[model samples]
Target chain A: MKHRGCGKDLAKVSEFIDGGLPAAMCRRIRAHMDDCRPCRDFVASLRRAMALHRAQGRAPSPPPLAKAELRDALRSCTAALKKRKPR
Target chain B: MPESESALISRSREGDPAAFESLVRRYEDRIYRLAKNVCAGAPAEADDVYQETFLTAFKKLRTFRGGSGLGTWLYRIASNLCFMRLRSNKRRPFVAALDLPSGEGLRLPADSIPTPEQAAGKRELAEAVARALKLLPVDYRLVLTLRDVEGLSNEETAKVLKVSVAAVKSRLHRGRLFMRERLAALSEGAA
Candidate 1:
């Protein structure tokens, strides 16, 4: 078997975080991170960045203007439908 | 029982505007945020994309054949509109450095502890994140937002972006690296 260097493992770090790898492979990466300080820091950083991004998603609600415009459009579509219906 | 999305979709396809409106209400916030992020936090651009997405979805509602969830379908529409707008305006895509030279000597201690309270106040952290995200190229930003931010599964994200799963993963990996490096600076500043 070919030796998987830090570069290769680092490339797959996201996959590992995602649980996309097989259990054995996950264990291998875990073992590698245990001894590899750089890989450890890299994975830590990736996880933190993702967490921050997710937080960013939660901070802002959809702007009110966008919602109002969409509602208005829906109402217009509804009005058009009513106009076409036989009374 | 309340109508399932499929039933709502059925009624929507039959010219029931209320049904369609309900669907829009269900997904409007998500679609808007996606647009906002895809437009790199430009509110005006986000608003345009949000409105256009629903209008397009409304115009083409009949083409929806219950293959995917309503959210997934809407995301596909929103994603397309966002990218189209970005391309028409000739925004440069951010190119990621695929081969990271090494993390060996880099001393970014701020990467380790990153809870909301520890890094910065919630609002500050969010602003930092938004600023960092905006610096990324559209493709990388989209991939990161979909997977990491929007909480979409890899397969679902690939479907939304109309890319292969491998492509999604590759983009996601590179995007993650870009975001990590960018945010590390913010984190250090905040600390």
Candidate 2:
């Protein structure tokens, strides 16, 4: 597996970082990293950056819609819909 | 917050203010996050997008054909509002995609607030990421924000954005690549 991992070395780095590689490929990357400093650094940094980006990507907690705001918006929305209804 | 989509939709359709409130309670967080991502984290713009998304959804309730889940449908509306807001504001695109590994999206970090001293650093990183996302085109920004940030799947994103699954993937890949580049640059700059 290490000898014949994904043909593209660098892409395999990214793939391995992402866990996108198949099990055999993962084994290969693991073996390759045991001796590959540059690839290892790339993977480590890529992992960190990915961790940050993904952290920021989490669904944000929405600002609570106060009872007043919801009621008000609903009233207006309903009014608009009724106003547009065909007589 | 509304407990169920159907219940919320039905109540909202009937002009039941309490039901509408419940809907907001249920989905406001997801909607705001989607809005925040689409609007590039501009508090003012996010607010507008958020307000307009729900208002528009409420007004259009009677016409909803039940073709999809309400949250996904609302996401479509929120993304649209984000696009319109961005266009109107003439904001630039977001270009940050720090190339990460796959299955990465599934490992969200647990929430924690920094101490007062660390708040600045945490916020700076957050803002830098936001600034990079600002470089994406409106379509890419809206789609990635909804799909990646908001945790919607490709099919759901496609349905909401009214695009085919292939289009969603294409946009997502492109947006993520762009985001990675920006994030890498930001890290280098900070270093």
Candidate 3:
């Protein structure tokens, strides 16, 4: 439960997991995790949570009826614009 | 060959309805997805956000300088509309303290390591995750949805949110930690 020394390094764990950090920084984080059990658990769980969300795929597409409505609305808007410009 | 997006943009700006429609068709799904996630509690609001995003883009197409990709531009518009709708509805405050202390909240129990396989099989856990996402501060939720759910790159996310990359990283880090803690608590409660 000792979190005093782990705060700064733990903040970078997200970047490290995403491979967004430089190699040397990654090395430093790995070194930190090796000694900090709480940070290690937090990193593992965060990775798992992210993986779960990714597995769910993108949000669902709009329904077909909604798509049709949007298309109609856009058509009307475009028609209005064309009338105004007369092109 | 099909017209490039830039060509489509040019044509749309010239008052070609078909060309404009093409642009909308190309991005409607993704824009709608962003809206759905941002307005998770209100399907109707999500629809409004999606429609307004495209309509606004159309009206302003002449102003689009092609500095950002069409998709990025569309995302920026949609994200703004979503934020406005959220704010007007008064369901959630637009600004929460983003400077949350790191690693100060709930810790994941060492023994209960979550795996993708376990999460996949547990419908309640998935529901819990969805609920947790909705409960996040809007800023954190938007960051998570863009980065994690929609698979936008960090750079793209920063562009959509109009924030620095460091800010995106900071919000994303805090958001993920928050979700992890929520999921851990839910799992413990269910166990």
> How accurate locally, in lDDT, is each candidate?
0.76, 0.66, 0.76
Ranking by lDDT: 3, 1, 2
lDDT for position B150 in model 1 = 82
Task: Kindly report which residue stretches of model 2 are placed more than 4 angstroms away from their true locations once superposed.
Answer: A1-44, A57-70, A79-87, B1-3, B88-115
Candidate 3 per-residue C-alpha lDDT over B143-178 given as tens digits, one digit per residue, 9 for 90 to 100: 888998788889989998899988999889877877
Best by DockQ: 1
- Give a tens-digit lDDT track for model 2, residues B1-191: 41677877787787776787778777777887776766666777787777777888777888887888778778878877776777754455444433333312222223577676467667777787788677677787767776656666777778888889778766766666566556665655665
Worst 10 residues of 1 chain B by lDDT: B100-109
Which runs of model 1 end up more than 4 angstroms from their true locations? A1-4, A81-87, B88-121, B189-191
Residue B87, candidate 2: how far off, in angstroms?
Answer: 3.0
Tell me how many clashing residue pairs each candidate has. Answer: 1, 23, 0
Point out where model 3 deviates above 4 Å.
Answer: B88-123
- Count of clashes in candidate 2: 23
**Taking the true A–B contacts (Cα pairs closer than 8 Å), what share appears in each candidate?**
0.53, 0.28, 0.41
